[model samples]
Target: MADPTTATPASGKPGHRRRRVRDLRAMPGFTTTAWITIVTLYLPILVLVAFSFNENRSVVLWTGFSLDWYAKALENDGIRNAAWVSVKVALFATVISTIVATMAALATTRTKKFAGQGLVFGIINQPLMIPEIVTAIATLSLFALVKKITGLSGIGYLMLAHAAFCIPFAYMPIRARLETMTLTLEQAAADLYAPPLKVFTLVTLPLLGPGIVAGAMLAFVVSLDDVIITLMIAGPGETTLPIYILGAIRRGITPEINAVSTILVAVSVLLVILLFVVQRRMQR
Candidate 1:
């Protein structure tokens, strides 16, 4: 074992890196630590999924395996309504956030450096820096004021809140893609007398499409998983799936929640796979 109390001498040999790589398997407790970490992270999810198929009502006690809970989860009107609301909010938020973020990414990446560029970047990424509860409370206050002024309280407020919060999540991937992209194609189009709008739509946008899709997927997942902000801004009839899950959890744990959770996890995994596939194809 390497000395814990004393500083180890640094290796200056050319073959030192390969030797370290070969010795990684010999490190004390390496395999045990990795197995423990994996079990700690994934064991609960596997247990939940297993119990979700239990024929018995008790979530903790597993009986014979069955699919009744999934059927129940599907048939529950409250669950259906909440799931629909979540889907709607996620779709709208993803669309609006992706569009706005795409434009913002282009502006930040394409334009010459300006005096306020740093400030603009900071503002765009404020949500990532600040605690979400702070943003939620602030958004709630703003919504209340707006509602008072206009006497309106619809699901649009929920959509707007999600879109506002997800902007940074969507912006980052798009900006990264734009940064890595070469300007040769766009420059060639410009030299041939193509207008800026035409160049963006015909050339840049196609190349950026995968990144836009990835950003939209990320924003959608974030909005779907968000609880605090949705709870704060949600009206009586605008409950999303996360809000519904929170209420259900407060009441008690049930196999119904496990079924719903398993379904959501499956869908999320599928979307992630799709996002990766799209990005890989684009790279090819």
Candidate 2:
């Protein structure tokens, strides 16, 4: 007997019923909403990039396209100094954060479940969970105390503060990579009578290299663009590029400011692309 649920329509040749499945993409206004969201997010950035090439002093006024602003930004001593400072801080922060994050990832992932493991993870990621303003304020108080007690002050303070916050950013990628890796290879190396240190040097380190690089790149970008923490930790004559940009904006937005911002955006985008490429290769 033919079941009613399987009954065919009048035009159907067989009793097979075709269900009408609705696709999310076919939903009303889905495409329009997606386009609107993308435009809203990126249009301002497009405008900023466009004005970076403007020849006129006015940022909004349309003028002939020129590279004069970029050239001026390069020649400006303040900009150059600030850029140098940013690079130095970012490098130090990247190194410190990457090393600490790598070690923390290995410790947490390679061991058996134990007491306080979740607590350890929480401590490592505390900075990320807390607001940047809170971290800045706490860092300021600590540094102020150290300065009062030891009277020691320099770019080192900024480097340490940046590294402290960058650790969680660096930790995430390394931990994810470690979790995805299988233990088979490491176990085989152990079966060959290889020392733990030798096995790690030849096997584990090579496999983990891409994640380490990705984490370092991410940490570098975070430290480079840091404003609030740097502002709080930096001493006199220790301005970074972001701080310099803040000063410039306060004075007035200029073509030079736009040019510098565009350059910064370019660097950040390039690093992020490289990080993505490395991770994709690691997946294979």
Best by lDDT: 2
The TM-scores, one per candidate, come to 0.89, 0.92
- lDDT, candidate 1, equals 0.91
Query: What's the lDDT for residue 262 in model 1?
Result: 90
lDDT of 2 by residue, 108-206 (tens): 999999899999999999998988998999999999999999999898999999999999999999999999999899999999999999899999999
Worst 10 residues of 1 by lDDT: 1-10
Clashing pairs in 2: none
Model 2, runs deviating above 4 Å: 1-25
Global fold similarity of model 2 (TM-score)? 0.92
> Per-residue lDDT tens digits of candidate 1, residues 11-94?
455366556656765878888999999999999999988998999999778779999999999999999999999999999999
Model 2: which ten-residue window has the lowest total lDDT?
A: 16-25
Q: Predict model 2's lDDT versus the native.
A: 0.92
